[model samples]
Target: MPRIGVYNGFDPVDVCSYCIEVLKVTAMGRASLRAMPLTHLKAYLSAYGLRGPSHAVEKEDYVRAVLDARQSNGCLPRVNEDYYRRHSIPQPTGERPKGFLARMAESFSDFVDSLPQPDLSSHAPPPPPLPPRQTAPRPPPRTTANRPPPSMPPRPQATPGPSNSRPAPQPTQSNPPRQSNPPPPPPSTQRPTPQPLPIDNLLTMKPEELSALSIGVLKAILQHHHVRIPQDALEKRDLVDRVATLVEAARAEKEREARARAAEEEAELEAQRQALEEIERKKKAAAQKDDTGASEGQASQEEIPVAVPKAAAHAAAKLERDGLCVICQDEDANIAIVDCGHLCLCLGCSELVMQSSKECPLCRTRIVTSQRLLRIFKT
Candidate 1:
């Protein structure tokens, strides 16, 4: 008889189905009821409250599996790309809500209020104000010659001081009556002088973002306050900061790129050095071959004392033998720079080689004609 076996391959851990059902119900808290399938809709019913614990776990696991499969299959919907950004979901870790619904409602209200109101595209413009009417000028009142002068009250007299032992006497004074016509208001002292804005200072402001403000409002506000920045200044300030930051970032990035390029050049130089070493190794190998292959008649145990570096040996010999510029071999030497040798064909080579390149092909010394080079041999 064949042995009985449980389900095979990708066997999920056994979980109570009843427990899963309850979990599925909770996890589906925000799922749209209208779009949910009939079978899922039936399972979500509150009638399942009386179900057993094992059944709930199993249902949750099943729902979890379904969601997992969908996600793995690359079909999961993106509900909130911007929802969880740098500052989104600012809740602290290791926290649990006392009540979920209340929190949700409050968060939702705050988020909704944060959005700007829609423009009223249908509103009509207000009519322009009416013009003022013209009025006739009134004539000044005529003065009467027979009019009696008004009586005037006497100014208050100072109270007399009493003797040291005598009691002080008290006197009563009535309060002044209020007048209907008040004294003419003090003359206006304000000067209507128009001041020119310092174009140099205002030019420092980010003009790109200034288009939002009216010229009148900008000029008025810029006046009377030089340091206290307005809230709208943030809009302009952000652009300035952005440009500055971009420039800084660009500089940093350029420096980084330059460093990378320099590192690459250094690596390339090292490779070239290795290649030259290899070439020298090959040359030494060839020289050894030539020495070994020499016939007995031509070969001598006492080798000729030739300079190891053939090129430098030639220059040393030429300077010693000729006592002149090896190039022109001119006995008459003149026109020299300090430290550098005065060996050249003529004044033409002196100008061309000295001024044009200034580098000696032999030692690679940079020669400055004005600085002058020493004549090791006067010739």
Candidate 2:
């Protein structure tokens, strides 16, 4: 008989369906909805035949509702490239609502749109078309021969004789001309101010990205980086080139300084190592010297210096052969008495002996100067 297997709630088909739904909502639908402005989001819902959120509803709620609708509809009527192009959603100039003020403005705009608008065409009728302007018929031009002579009234000859005596000169009043104010100066043309770019990641921006900015903005960037713009660099391309050159130079300089600092640190470490080695060598030499002094004292105590006139020559020869200084007997005789020409003092004892006696220890002759000597021995 076959063994019965226990049933678990894991189903591949159900998991696959859940994954597809998640992809549709999150990867495709929800992201686009969240990025859209309130107007565009409503337009998107209307385009897909889904109920758009009310003016009072929050933006997140609207986004979630849209996502749910898309999921329930099995991803049909999707917010894909075709839908964007058809409905003109996410217009190039449109930006998503940013801060509190922007969100409030978006909410207010949605509320205004929700209100019923009066039909302007029916309420305010268009003015009737103005009747065609009536123009009088033009009369025909008259020739000199057909033209009528001017009519003249008969002049009163009797009244002309008494005109000066009868008519008193009326008082003539002259009026001053009115002064007019001068016209205002024409409006001056303003240079366009640079606007900050949406992308603030200037450090990692490429040359092409910088080139896309306007000349004013490029200058602003150069100013921000404290890079000097050359007097002759007027064009946008020239500014971009200048910026690239300066940035590269700065980077190179920084790297060079870093390398110099590292080299200095390494030199300091090397000097410290040499100093440590020198100290260790001195310590070892001192330790050996102490041991030798102890052994020499022990030997001196064991042996007694008798009056040995017969073996004096043999003892001097033995001291020379052993390369021991006569005064110290611990170090090598590496210094020579100048006048007497005897190597009997070690470098350490030579200074002390000369200061005390000012004469050679072996010959007892007046010493002029002491000189350090090097000895070579044949194997």
Candidate 3:
């Protein structure tokens, strides 16, 4: 077949590398198991299959989760053979592995053992105690004391010593400022008002969930919180629709920002890609560039000599000799290179890879997202 030359914007494989780098796995969290090589992860998965080694997988995931968090920024390294060898630990096979691979596995295991485990504290609340039995009220105490009685006076003949001076000026108390004895409210001063807690509104919340939601989230929650509304309550429908629309728009905006961030990181990492070195190797490419073109009275804009196809091929062969993939292998099965040549599988494997790693799988060259994905086959 004739050698097909494609000059496009970016390579898919390189893009994938960007993605991988952004998605760093090392920081993904080391299992509490310790600094285990990443290889044992495969073994762990293999051993458990369906019902998992909860502890092991959890440990791995914990670390991977951390890495995943950073992947969005393309700051993570690619998961390649080296990565697997460097990070993975082998599980204990009943009969130990023999030879170099076996020894390597053992070493990896040591690394895992070196990882720290999360402390599993028993902080869960104890079960509720049985209700106390009702008790009868106690009677007042009867004190025993000898007492003297009777000093009786003769009954006073009706009414004299009358209204002695207006009943001794009716005794009065300067009532201390009427004590404001209001009941103390519950501990949390931030309890939602009962008005906002209509049966309908409360229902939408998670069962017994006190969502500390923002105003926008709150409005969205309201739409679904209430149970049933009357047919004629068009206002409810309108409000719900409005809130839903607003929420969707906000979520979309957030996602766009996240992707943009990832893209930026991918670009930075790509700028450091090694593939550009091919440009330095080619004399023809160098000759194509007119260093004095600027002073030569620029006819139209002068174009610089980019790396040539032959040089790129030689770079690829060299990288292969060093055991590197021709293109940056993003996590995806496929990869892509742009303009200078090639594409991975049909899907935008390059883009996906870019999201994960910074290095190309094939040439192990550093790459950027600005490189175009020219649809051409890799030799």
Tell me, by TM-score, which candidate is best.
Answer: 2
| TM-score to true structure, per model | 0.18, 0.24, 0.18
Instruction: Give candidate 2's error at residue 260 in angstroms.
Output: 0.6
Global lDDT of each candidate: 0.44, 0.57, 0.43
**Model 2: per-residue Cα lDDT over 72-151, one tens digit each:** 43453445535534653333435542433234456678999999988797755455454445455678986678656777
Which window of 10 residues has the lowest lDDT sum in candidate 2? 370-379
* Superposition error at 120 for model 3 (Å): 85
Residue-level lDDT of model 1, residues 337-360, one tens digit each, is 444443443333454566577766
Superposed model 2: Cα runs more than 4 Å off: 1-203, 224-232, 294-379
Residue 10, candidate 3: alpha-carbon lDDT? 26
Q: Across residues 114-197, which tens digit of lDDT does each residue of candidate 3 receive?
A: 999776556444444554454556889876787577589878666667543223334344443555889998687675633333
TM-score quality measure for candidate 3: 0.18
Candidate 2 lDDT score at position 290:
80
